[model samples]
Target: MHAGGIGAPTIARTLNEEGIPNPTSYAKLTGYSWHNRPSSSLWSAGCIYSILHNETYLGTLCQGRQLTPEGQFHSKKNIPKDQWVRTVGHHPAIIDDELLRRELKARKEAGAHNLHEQKKNFPPGIFGKEVRCASCGKILTKGKTLRKTGCERTLFCPTRKKSPSHCKGAFISEKHLESAILHELKNLADRYSDDRVQIGICQDAQSADLIQEKNRLKTAVELIEKEITAYEQRSRDLYLKRATDGMSIDDFNSALSRIRNDVDKLRLKSKRASSELLHLNESIAAESIRMETVLKAADFNHLDKTKVSMLIESVYVHKRDPKSGTQAIDITWKF
Candidate 1:
């Protein structure tokens, strides 16, 4: 179908119309150990598109294309194409290189055309990165609608278009978001200004506590290091006693093993303490910088992209309540 200039969706529809089994069904029929069930026992545009773009049919083996970080089986992140391990002619070719190249080129051209249309329909908005869907945590995409007065902008969860069950009714007007941000900024500024002295006193106490903790961690690390050194020295002494003092080989080995175990434990303790101190220092530095930015944001009466980026970390918009017709907007400030 791709060779005949038929799109993936049309190909999927044709396959379903002919009552052909989808990949999952085919795998199950062929006695493959398939575990996951498809949403429907039918071909989908996504499945068709994936098959069309796959290089494996061209006798190429690709691995390490994605990575699942330690303990995060579900959060697979794509590695860069340059880093992906690919071996050509690793298996019998089902599709010729020429055919695969042509299909890829055609798909790229089609994608470019679709992207142009999308850009024209939905020009980028200021809060594209900063706004998110509270339910799915996906970045809200910018869109616009033509009103009688002008083009009205909105930030909406794009997941609703693909998976409505995940992020339903996640939409907010850009104007409404700006108003909320400005209001929050005003409130924050008033609070800071009104309780400056009390805040300073509290912060001073916190700073002292952090300093004390940092010192304690540093001391612990130093002590652990010294203990490790002592164990190493004892090991060396045992070796000398075995050679010069006629110490039994078994006794020497036993003492050396105990010393090595103690050293390993002390080194682990030292590493933990050092890591804690490093984190504490980083937190102190970040807090100082954030406080400066927060104070600067106090003077902002109107919102701009630059000021928003400086002060706001993220803005999560929850689904609107059907009864009250109100939505919850949660803002995470840098400070």
Candidate 2:
């Protein structure tokens, strides 16, 4: 094969059948563990790429650090192999570790792709949909730092932010936002778990009230219709009296007009009340479903993409600990 030729990803089923490693720790260390349903090609390919480029593959690198566009972007001139901190020959090899390290070095020098990069979905944030820079119409992105410091992701268009000069959208890290949301969730969970907690969410009480209101509205609508019917009858009687010469034309016309206005008012009120009642009923039903979700939410440890989309409004990742070195994701509830 030529040096620049693209390598096709091995089919997932074939990779598993041949006892190649995957993302699962057992698979990565042992070989072919996920039996009933193996990791799909997408996930397996990701794993293969990570393993190949991992400086740790040769036991030569641990936590290989590189600068990002969002971090102190590094240049090729300053980085070296020894300072990279290698721990060679620790694990069994599937590919040539030396080749991987070389490629890794080259790629790192080029400023693209990483384990963390894998976490971000390509094509960037939901910008054209969610928020815009108002100025440049370009999407704002996460912050830049002198070193590997955590910054929130911002939403602004590239043209606006980078600018031939239209918008330098104020950027914020999604990370910080995410952390706040996570803290809120954890706090809420703890509060619910407390044995001595006295507070009630009042959902049941609220539901009862909603039901009562709906009934009241129905009754009110009936009364309104009765009033409207009375007014309608009065209008007809006045018109008939004038036509039969029982009342003056002026008096008949005035009385009929007044009665018609009353009937119209009553009808409008009845319609509004009916709509409100319907909405109240719908709200109660929705709340019931929401409470059920809350009750069952404890079962989930990790939220998959689909679930997160349905249940969460947005996710924010923020505030990296310099010491601990782990990223946190904060998810906002849809509510």
Candidate 3:
């Protein structure tokens, strides 16, 4: 369907109409009852999108796309694409490279068109990308609605339309949001004036130390990556010996398991070092501005784009309480 220029939504709808079993249903049919239940039994556009983007059909094996940090339970973060271990031609191709390339191009063009339409309809507000839905952590989209009084600007989560299971949704009036932000700014200014808080201003010496640490982390990551590659190679050689040298199944399994464990450890180490390196780079690139100075000069009577950009990192708005009719707003400071 993608190769024929059918959009993901249309393909998903067609599949649902045809009574085709979705991936989760098919997995269950194959006796894989351990998988989590899907939110819906029907095909979805997101599933189609994932299928279209997957390179496994092109005979490529991709691994390490997700990593669980050490000591963390039931939580994983996506590894950067450049850090993913990929082996091309690892299996017989199910889809040609040309088809994959065409599908990718079509998806990119569709995404660009959708972004343009969204911008044209929504038109970014003062908060723009800084306001997030606390439930889903998605950036709240700006919107406008006509009321008896006049037009009202609002920020709302867009994720509800696609996956309400993740976030029922959140909405906040622009005026109310601005008021809350101004109040917070005022409080910050008052606290600074009273000498109740001290802002850590990054200096030249601190930047130099960060850069040094970054270099050290980069070296550590490279070494860890080399160790992973060596272990992977050892596993392959073991497999080859087991097949051709008539090695005992138990011994082969034991050796392969140890090598896999070592490789997993190295990958985790590389992920942590790479994460630290990324943070160091961001710290070095960020402008070293004193939060106290910005707070002292801020007017706090209204929202100023310049001041907000410099002082605030993001604002997360939670769903309103049913009984109290109040919303919780959390702000992250850039300092």
Candidate 4:
């Protein structure tokens, strides 16, 4: 339950990234204005199923469990949360203790936590990391506007209070910003049709042919092994000299421990590199193909929002680009 705990919007975003299929539940992305789903036991049951089976709330990684023959379990088992092995520090978890408890409470009372009254009211465009309030240095938030005037994206000072200080609550009209963004975005869309972007990535991928890539990886592994062997020999020589000369065991042991730790790290890195290389070599052609596909698509629609979302990390608006009036959109995507 760090900023926004696992919620309906989280479910939608996860599906979008993983290519899972689900019928729309909200009228818009990151919106609570429900799409007015057809009321039926079937819908209610699905909601119940989604709540019960979802793994996000538990902070546990999941893989579909499989069974084996000889009456033995395969690589999968639904172990308890306490026993599940976790990869520490891999990624931020969506859920924590408090949200998990509250979610169960809400589900027991209502059908799902979603039906519970929202705790934090926010503005719509403020849903993502996009809106910045020029005043508070905080991203503007989304919420329902008073007088039922539809969603308003706004900036506010939470330090003052939860209630909106509409007096100081300055907002960028989303329509106007989207208009400005689109005006610049059109060129990005035009860049979609540019072939050179695709060509550059394709050329890079092609430069490292699959067989050559595998060989290079193997060579790197061999070099790491050579370094490890050399280090071990050096440590051994130090130990023998110290033994023959009656050197201080404390100093000798300290040096030996440091050397051993280095060796251990080196071995681990070597193994990791080797494993990574094996996977990459296997998928070299496939990844190259995927890159080619993305390149072609990027060339086709350089500025599509969805495509832009994948490739671009940030777009810096520049005064020079605006002044020029030609190539006014100064843009950079991982291109």
Per-residue error for 29 in candidate 2, Å, reads 53
Candidate 1 lDDT at 96 equals 80
What's the C-alpha lDDT at position 63 in model 3?
98
lDDT of 1 at 121: 71
TM-score for each model: 0.46, 0.41, 0.39, 0.26
Per-residue error at 267 for model 3, in Å?
Answer: 38
Which has the better TM-score: candidate 3, or candidate 4? 3
Highest TM-score against the true fold, candidate: 1
- Best-fitting candidate, scored by lDDT: 3
Off by over 4 Å in 4: 1-213, 285-335
Tens digits of per-residue lDDT, candidate 2, 46-127, equal 4556666555555553533443455555752434554665556666555576666565567566446653564563323322
lDDT per model vs. reference: 0.77, 0.53, 0.78, 0.51
Candidate 4, TM-score vs. the true structure? 0.26
- Using lDDT as the yardstick, the better of models 1 and 4 is 1
Candidate 1 lDDT score at position 107: 80
Candidate order by TM-score, decreasing, is 1, 2, 3, 4
After superposing candidate 1, which stretches have Cα over 4 Å from the reference? 1-126, 129-176, 186-209, 239-244, 309-314, 318-327, 333-335
Q: After superposition, how far is residue 171 of candidate 1 from its true place, in Å?
A: 7.3
TM-score of 1: 0.46
**Model 1 lDDT, residue 26, Cα:** 82
Report the Cα RMSD per candidate.
Answer: 13.5, 20.1, 23.5, 21.1
lDDT of 2 at 261: 81
